[model samples]
Target chain A: MDETDRLIINSLQGNFPICDRPYLEVAQQLGISEDELLSRLQTMLDNRTLTRFGPMYDIQKLGGSFSLCAIRVPAERFEEVTEIVNAFPEVAHNYERDHEFNMWYVLATESPEQITHTNQAIEARTGLKVYNMPKIQEFFVGLHFQA
Target chain B: MDELDRKIITATQAGLPLVKKPYAALAEQLGIDSETVKQRLRNMLDKGQIRRIGAVPNHYKLGYMANAMSVWNVPDDKIKELGNQLGALPFVSHCYERPRFLPEWPYNLFAMLHGKSREEVADKVQQVVKLLGEYCVGYELLYSKQILKKTGLRLKAKD
Candidate 1:
């Protein structure tokens, strides 16, 4: 990633314009042409520098639900269990953490009750306990990383 | 959201097209005008249904390899004040108050700290420790070993 790439990452994290020529407007602000900005963004995304490039929807506000769930898989079966847990379409984000609760993932469902439904399905499949840690309150969410 | 809005979301949820006229592309796909597509997105943004429209970078790939979810056991009454303070910190990305399962899990406050290395993360944790002081009964830094999956917020399409 060059200086221009860094500038693109930092500038476009949020508040991207909603106009017809949004990219053109952004490129102007960053002192780059629309074509250059588009190509840079495409390359960054292709290389996994930017995991996603689009609108971030608030699932809860849209009558959907989200819960952070974890599981403790035996060391030997970690990989197998990961495959099993991740097979569920509802498991949006999963991670291997350094703790007893080694596996952590977020479940995004269409409704509040689906949160429980998905957890139960995972437990039934994995035969391991799923700890659901739904947020009682959200204090913050947005954070920008200077690339 | 109406059916048209849902169609717009389903079309762009993956991403805006990498084209000169991205919204127009979406409109073309949905068989709607560019103006309507832009207006629905704007409306969703206004209603907070859409947080923002932009790039979501991979922090690990961006050199923020050391990201720790710092969980704290703080008194329920003090959480409101403490969570806000932690959230205000530039390094802390996400902060929230969650339910704690005693005996196994005892963390009510969760703050995500990002850094270039574990040492940097530990240093930030110290800042949080000092900020919490006596209110924090216990804490743990769960460093992620791997990102197994990270496809953000996918809504299943209607049948």
Candidate 2:
């Protein structure tokens, strides 16, 4: 990435303007034309450098529940267990980590009750205990990656 | 929290379109005026329903591929103070206080760190360790090996 690309990513990490000509406003600040700014963002999105560009909604506030759940799967049954856990659509992100609790995933459901239901279904299918580790509190959750 | 709110979310959850007047385009599709769309978005932002409206860069794609979930077992009383300190660290993108699973697991603080390499990440982690010093009883860095499934919130496909 060039200096301009880095600048765009850093500047637009949050607080994107909400107006008829938001891009123009951002462009004015960045010392570029609206078309140039828009095209750069477009290219970044298309190339997967920027995963998303928009409002990040809080699912819990929207009557949904999200939790970080983990499982310890034996090496032999790792793929099988992953498949079983991922069968549920509520599973949003699943990762393989090098730890006793090898498999970690985020469970996102429309309702709070569904989180338990999904856990039950996962345990029933995998025959392994599911550890639901929801956040008790959030001290802070805002950061901008300065590229 | 109404039908219109749901529609607005489902419409803009993925992201706003890349146009000069993106809200106007969204309003046209939702059969609402540009002003209403803008106002509702502002309301959601003010209500904390929407964290922020902006671009989310893929750190991995941006060359900071080595990432680790560095969790710490901190004292309950000092958790908030330590957590705030950890959150303030530039490399620590996300910091939170979670419940401790005694006997088996005992981590209460979680901080996500990203860097260009594992060594870089480890170096940054040492900074956190020194910063937390006596407050942190124990800690572990769980580096993700691979992403099995990484789907962001999908409001429309499920519907």
In CAPRI terms, where does candidate 2 land?
high
lDDT of 2 by residue, A1-147 (tens): 788889999999889999999999999999999999999999999999898899998767777788999998999999998888778889999999999989999998877799999999899888899989888887666668777
User: In every candidate, how many clashes are there?
Assistant: 0, 0
Q: What's model 2's TM-score?
A: 0.96
* Model 1 misplacement above 4 A: A76-84, A124-127, B148-151
Question: Model 2: residues >4 Å from true position, as ranges?
Answer: B156-159
Q: Would you give me the overall lDDT of model 1?
A: 0.90
TM-scores for chain A over all candidates = 0.79, 0.93
Model 2, span B47-157: residue lDDT tens: 998989999998878888888999999899998888888998988888888777777889989999989999999899889889999887999999998899988766653
Q: In model 1, how large is the Cα lDDT of residue A55?
A: 92
lDDT tens digits by residue: candidate 1, A1-147: 999999899889899998989999999999999999999999998999998899988767777889998898999999999999889988899999999989999998878899999899889988999999999998888779889
Give the winner by lDDT.
1
